[model samples]
Target: MKTKLWFLLGTLALLLTGCQSKNNSGSAQQLNLMQTSDLLSLDTSQHADLPTWNTLENSMEGLYRADKHNQPQAAMATKVVQPTNQGKTYTFSLRKNAKWSNGEPVVAQDFVTAWRRSVSSKAQSGYNYIFSGIQNADAISKGQKAPRKLGVKALDKHTLQVQLEHPMPYFNKMMVMPAFFPQNRTALKKFKSHYGTQSKYLYYNGPFKVTKWTGDNDSWVLMRNKYYYDKKQIHLNKIKYLVVKDANTAHELFSQNKLDDATITGVTAKELQGSKNLIHEKKAGNYYLRVNVRNNQPLANAKMRQAINLAIDRQALTKNILADGSLPASTYTAKDLSIDPTTKKDFAQETTPQQTYNVKQARTLWDEGRQEANLPKKLTLKVLGDDQTITKNVAEFLQDELQHNLPGVKVQIRNVPDKTASSETRSGQFNLSQTLWLADFADPISFMGILNSDNPQNYGKYHDDQFDQLYQKAILDSSNNQQAYWQTLRQMQARLNESMPVIPLYQMVESHLVNPKLQGVLRHPVGEDDYTRAYLK
Candidate 1:
């Protein structure tokens, strides 16, 4: 009887210990989510992919973040500022209460430092070109000027001033982009080359702080930032993410209640149908093809490029292969992204179809291209793409379509991890590569700017003097003459239609199984998913 009494006491003690540990971990206030790809990098300037940027959006605070209405809202900044100097300058007042994870106060100098570092020639930031209109930014990126002269200054500890080369109509909206996030110079100096490679090497000031990341881990956790300015408003105390590439695995995990949100597409999405837990989110992004025209003579031929573009049946790829509510793309920009101020027409509606499925025309163009270029009767080309289920499916479909429609062409599909595929394509090491671009802001130029001759992201190396001139006019006239700006963009789209440098496949719609109990998650059309205000109901 005495031994039984002791055993019961020990069991009660064990239960109490477990409860204490659970409370310490804040399990009740935690969220579990999934990402389709691994986290590549945490460095805002270096990362070009969506997953990394999305993670940054939650852990790092910028001057602005998108609200539920997809409008710019104050984050690190106390309020959004109106531009001066004829819309060429902006001065922001930062929140004095803001503090970084390392216990240092977040000041205006942080923005100045980060802006300079991003635009520096040595950074090789893929998104730095987004700062094209900033005074001296282009010169600094080209190594012609010092980073100190790159148009940003710390007017005071709490005030930041930015000068622009021209009036950027979207400058306010673009503040929410990851490229504009502040960096702690102390952390950078301490970690040096290893900064932002792991959770411990960096600091955070947003709603959450990354933990348990070891640079190459497939999983990570974000704990609530104790130092955040608006900490009381943040609901989820911890957010966890795991890389689940396969849709079936994600679905199974979601069904088992191991995940609060699961990203599923293709067959799984179609099967889910009308489930109350399922959420369909149409992204302001599009998947497209980049041809290595700079290195390949055959692909450089406009007829060859046009033939390749016309051969793919985008409708089948979207409806049959993707089957996730994705729309077949015709314009570079996704539909409903922007409506013309005067005409009130969607950007995609205003532009003509760049390329359409036409097996007959594709075959004719293929033969004529070969004849014009004095090429062989039979030709082979390799395509590089990510190994993700959806992307791989698309790549395989492209291979079959190109081979079957072009008659004399043999296609090879090479699948690699997203990171390797991105690097290889950027370096011009592939004949053709599959890529996707999401808008940095709400503007159509965010998509059209990729084809600019000066854009580093222009992997295809497409160049036309007239196209370049039209693009510049669009930017310069953006705030001055809206009608001229709109017309120039239309003209640019027509140029792409004729040149066929890049191929537009479809606009992506992300399908997910989110827990019905979770509430207040804001999925923005032009920015990362906002979870700061999310909580379990």
Candidate 2:
């Protein structure tokens, strides 16, 4: 179940498309966008994928925005003032003219209701921990406290105050997410459990409003919100999103100008390289292989897990299979993120070998572990992966590499649809699975916090009491001792390496094809909503 949560975080950016064109002969009307992923559900609390969240972020406004540099900027809130001494209280003043698409006033109580619902025991939001520091959020989520005690209060129609159990430096950044976004209480009360179900029940207070949503159909539409406070800055009138799984066909549509943007596949990258519309972005995420520690099988052993990690040739996979500028990963964190600002070097430099494809080392370790465990004569491990070509290729490569390097070990490939794969991982149904983690915000805590034992995302049941304690200290401490925090983080990494619960694979390079004419387009490291200010030339 923990594996499913981590996997969901990684797969968010797997399918998004953008377009930009310099030829300005036509009028600036509706902006048509194409994306590869199909929205599973519009229920903000239930949907965890990036594509869905991205659309929601643009269509719905939040109290704050995580900027390109990873800093939180005020959005719906006019200002956020925190008490300097204790850092436990935050005062938020809403914009005077803020209102929903239906012209209803955007009140502070909207945020209060949304936060209370998210942390409610019945909500089961994977991102419930985002508010763990809130007054009684953790207790409420665990059913030990009531929603009213969850630290959020609407002082008035336009002002909200929040009390935290401890100081959190990233609280503002976390608020930029949908889990913290306000929901229409009227719609929620009327629709009950089906509040976000079709377009009608889903109200909007952001730059764009979801005008149409047909779940069974593969397409949906978003129109600019006329009542949005910053509506004058938004140029595109409407955005229509289509879900096309076939990468080749998607690229073909892009080439023909039928689609504004598309994610190029390995087969199409070279051909589209010379196109002026091609745009490449660095991904703030990492892909890895998670081994089920609770399986009580061969993979449950640390030695066997290390052996499998050493067997695969990640460099070859990146060059041959991925063909993207993805760097090999030696640690769970991405390369750029793994660097310690104080030392200006990677934290993994202190412990663990620089990643290499060492078949001899892998074979020896596997044989030793097999002998010690008194395992069956033949070893077989099941791998769960998404239906994407890249995932299938990676899984096949791992299966071949592990089997060829280790004499008795056999690998079975189980390629399931993305949703099904997610469900299986959440249900703890796999021996091994491919997963990725995208930072919820710029902070290292965004990635580190997910592994906490009580976190809903920790599906593999990997737990470390010491690591948990250090994480708590890092978040609660007021001193800006980032170096000390890194030191503690190094210790946590050491524990993860020793446990071998997961194998870090590679850090992906995000790329998209955009028309050169689309000005005001902002690309952030976290890639939150930057389309509000985007405009056509």
Candidate 3:
């Protein structure tokens, strides 16, 4: 009996020791996520939307970070040195302690590898034009030269040298994006097409690394990387993201405290008004009606675009449909963005607001446009958009307004999935479509520059040689001529208004209910969320 009792005590001691060891090894880190969309891909170069890019920006740190005041500060790059005489030569020295999640050192060659891959013809990166200024980048992407001859190079293990075709003032802000983010060549080679799908294949050098993603699933998680250079500053151990498309469902999750942040849309904004955590942010993007210029029928006429723009009651739409702080837009660029640095005046003042809904004017313009196109009776038009509440409401409003205002016109609403809607818009399939353009960085050119004829993001294929010249000159011009740049941008806006490829709808008012526990959440006017400084209270 004595021997059996001693043996039992020894077994209990061993079990307790094992339990303690397992408990100690378990992680104490966790970050709650609040998102409505599933991340399609982690490849930043291929992403076009601001929300997706913002997610990538949060998971990966860039070379620089723009402050709330729109000033670029060092992020991955320790210092940026520019030569006075060189038109566009900039040298970057990276931080010494930076290392990927796989324990490999982040060197200048990592950036060079990512850049070369993005600019390669085989990659077909959507953002290849962003590196057009780099020597041979355009030529290489066009298959005129090998990608090895691209201007971006690593002088040593730590120093990166970039030579551009022109001097860009907002170049620093561009560096703080995925196009400039470094990637591990070894990991890329190993994973090939599936590099960024899983945590094992993707090596993160940023604040957080993706732990799990069940491709297009509702639930995904991002965990803080212990090997990150500034891991001590990361407060959240894991970020849990869920794709709850319905606004009511998202609000329900937020109210239950299951989600740390959520966007209140539709009628939910009214009930959640004045909540302690309610926050409204004005976005640089604006919703607009894109008219397919390729269609040679009724839509090709500028008068028809004007008629559609004038027929809609924007005030009622905002009050009834939006019921938020969304402002009626007279131009593509928002009012906040029109503030000229030199003249201290709004640049979009020339495009006056059409406050009153003029049905009579709309009917007259519609008749003239139809007569010019030689169409007899009713005109059949198709409007395409996503099935979201806001988009559906806009489509319904336009259908009602146009049908009522013009006696011989009928509008058909075609609702599709979000991804399908985007693809259709890109292919110019619909006669009219709803779309939005979010500024990638805090520069007037970031918004206006995309209207260039050769720009991939120019969905409408709106072209103007003079507009392109002015936009190109604005970027190359020295920072000293502030007034000249503003004037040039205003001219571009005027020309866009004349072309009428798209009719401006309204500026977006983004609202979010965030948990009081999280602190240091960074929100930029350009609609980017940088969570590097974010931590739980």
Worst 10 residues of 2 by lDDT: 17-26
lDDT of candidate 1 over 332-397, digit per residue (tens): 778868887767898877785734889999999988988988889888888898888877888889
Model 3: how far is 89 from its true place, Å?
Answer: 1.0
The sequence of per-residue lDDT tens digits that candidate 2 reaches over residues 15-126 is 3212223222122555556655556666766657766686787788788876656677888898655554477888899998988988888999999998888887767558
Q: Deviation in angstroms for 362 in model 3? A: 2.4
Superposition error at 96 for model 3 (Å): 1.8
Cα deviation at 271, candidate 2, in Å, is 4.4
Off by over 4 Å in 3: 1-29, 80-83, 120-125, 138-145, 197-201, 295-297, 349-357, 478-480
In lDDT terms, which candidate is top?
Answer: 1
What would the TM-scores of all predictions be? 0.94, 0.90, 0.88
Clashing pairs in 3: 30-238, 31-238, 33-240
Q: Which candidate should be chosen as best, given TM-score against the real structure?
A: 1
**Which 10 consecutive residues of model 1 have the lowest summed lDDT?**
19-28
